[model samples]
Target: VSLSLALKGFGAWAPTIGWCAHQTQTCILLWAVSRLRPKLCWDKHRIKEMLSYGLGVSASGWVWYLKTLINPLIVGRFAGETAVGQIALAIRMLEVLSFAKAATYRISIAALAQLQSDGKRLKQAISEGMELQLLALGPILVLASWIGPIVFPLMFGEEWIPAMSIFPLLGVTYLTNAAFNLHCSTLYVLRRNWEVTAFHAAYVILFGILAFFLVPHSGIAGYAWAEVLSIVTYVVAHLSIHRLIGSPNYQIAAIWWAGFTIAMFSYQLGWWVVGGLGLAFLLPEARNRLTTYLKHFRALKTG
Candidate 1:
């Protein structure tokens, strides 16, 4: 079955091609490597350690899968298809946020794992990782929030107009998660895997609980608010676990929250763009960084 579907990918019908191709290629490479290094030693203790790690990974995967998978059912049951559809549509925007986060995680897990025992380096890495996440996702968040209402209604038709309302709040959810997303990786790399899983489990339960109260009363936006609440709870837990495990004191960032609040108010006052641009200057450090980036870009163009 896998073979036929993989073959179908050659004809450009790659429905399940990624998983099939990745597995097949991995097995083939591993077999080749084994044949090339036939005297490879297998350590029982090391295997056991890896197995423990794998178990934690498996639990986390299943827990999160169930969380995401079950969310739609709750939405559909409580809020109906229109709300579900709106949420589903808004989620496509989340993929954009995920891409920014994925890059930060890849670098963070690698760097943090190397510096796990060094308090100074780990702190530096964590601080910088959070900064990079903000740098990457910040402007995107601002632009999307500013433009989505005007764009989504036109882009997806009138039925999806409802999505524009909930999406900005979900963008807030994504932004909140990004603040502590790297901490989850740091916890996992430190072998505090269960903590990460526990955080996610709490997120799932809290989301469901919030959904329970909000969905029936507030409709689709209720689901979005539920997500916001869940993101807040989970990120707080993630950071507390980080500190409990001896991670450096990362300054709880209120800049984004403050800026967002101001922007929302400015938006109400019909000066959203001006207000959002004002955020760049909210912090002296951010202002300097923007100036440096602009200067470098100008230099590059001139030279």
Candidate 2:
């Protein structure tokens, strides 16, 4: 739809039209397959139950979304429209690259909820989920970080090249997100929404503060570094999950994450990319886990 519109010289309306068309199709498909009809009804008790659970999720989501505005508001104020555009481009690129991580996070919520009553299973599930998320994300990040500098200027325009400077930093930030986002999901499954809300609040607040101070001094790259530094605060979510289900052994994942992050940051220096990936792939624990995961996936496919 978008491509057709763009080709027809109506490119400005293509994205909106395409999005509406996709949503309309989804709604129609759900109506046909779900086989449920809405009835006019009112139930105060049910409303109260839903509000109790939903309000926290909504509140946390709203607060979490505020981080998105920091670049526009803070960076725009400190730098200018050009800086904001560069940051926006970098963020859009990350969004596209992080799609798999986002999908897994959503699906894992229901899966984690089923195991909520079993601590051992819950911890194991979180560990496995994190490993798979990293495995899926690592290659995409590496490839993008490697080729983006070369391809982006040609594809987008020479004016957008500066965006690639901070792309790797934001990539590492998303990589860290893949590592710990399931902890947030675990909190939700346990009905600990307020804790998640608190963590998100702190996250936005910290990002806002860092952007405020850094953008003026260091430019957009400062904004990216702020995101990388804010990852340390994920410990709040980690501790919250630990108190409930005990934390998973992240030793193996941590080593790989560190190596991958360095590789991305130094990919321009030539050998860091190979060295970092080599370290991650050669780790005995990571190789064993990957083998086990592949076997399980094959069994599920065949069975």
Candidate 3:
């Protein structure tokens, strides 16, 4: 719907949509500002920092959004709308799965800000956060595999059948992206935004280059492959950043490997049973993480 609105050309809807984004940013800014007191606070400097962080987040989102449109536009025009529409549906699933990590970013930022023991606690938090994210999203990846085919066509119209075929593969792409998000949140909280941009730029470039050849030969599957490859590369770069900042708990490496293995094997299991069980395993982990996160949130509210 948002895509369709944008495609109708910005003349009719740009102002309206732009206003919606403005209102959202304004609300965030106001809320942030309200937390400050004029006499007690470093008002100007803090406001500048808040706005800068907001812009970084917003710009990152905008860049991805532009590419999101560009990729589909080319595919739809050159390859055929059915193929493009199908890929678009697949990408939409990716977006839905990816939102889970947005929460991870918020949580990581809070953790980094409050937890004073940066060396030990920061490492633990990053590990725990990744574990929490994996446990939360692992089964979702399974469910997407099981039901995406049926759901995609129903949601986007039957013209999206090819999209369904490639949908399961793209589920891994989302998983990789979630992992990348964890790395990003940790990095950003530690003040490594430039690294994030560089990591993404390199990954996006490589993925685009791969897609030029792969898309023609493999169609939507190629696109899925490109996404997974790029995200995995970004994840590696993030690990490098973690090391540069300082060693996080080395245990995080093992957990990441284990989580990836679980995700890989689980994807093979038929959606209903395998995905359902994976989610069941995820519940306790999620409960613990959510509880910890909420405690911090409440503390922040009061403090």
**Candidate 3 lDDT, 1-303, residue by residue in tens:** 345567777665866887787799988898798996446556798899988887776665555555575367545555666677678767776677767767766776776767534556766666666656665676676556667666766777776677666665676666656655556766666666656666766776777777776777777777777766666566555565567555554344344434443444343554344443445435665446557767977999999
Better of 1 and 3 by lDDT: 1
Better of 1 and 2 by TM-score: 2
- lDDT of candidate 3 at residue 26, scale 0 to 100: 87
Candidate ranking under lDDT, highest first, comes to 2, 1, 3
- RMSD after CA superposition, every candidate: 5.4, 2.2, 6.3
- Model 2, position 182: C-alpha lDDT score: 87
Which ranges in model 1 have alpha carbons more than 4 Å from their true place? 1-42, 235-252, 260-269, 288-303
> In what order do the candidates fall by TM-score, top score first?
2, 1, 3
Model 1 vs. true fold: TM: 0.77
TM-score of each: 0.77, 0.92, 0.68
Best by TM-score, which number? 2
Candidate 1 lDDT, 1-303, residue by residue in tens: 556765755444454565677889898999998886456789999989999998996787677666665457888888787777788777877766569687776677777788778766666666656655765776677677677777877778988888777766777777667767677777777787887778878888888888888888999878888887787566555565557555544442445444653453234457755665576465777667557657876999999
Off by over 4 Å in 3: 1-66, 154-157, 249-303
Give the candidate number with the greatest lDDT: 2
What residue pairs are clashing in model 3? none
Which segments of model 2 are wrong by more than 4 Å?
Answer: 1-21
lDDT of each: 0.70, 0.88, 0.63
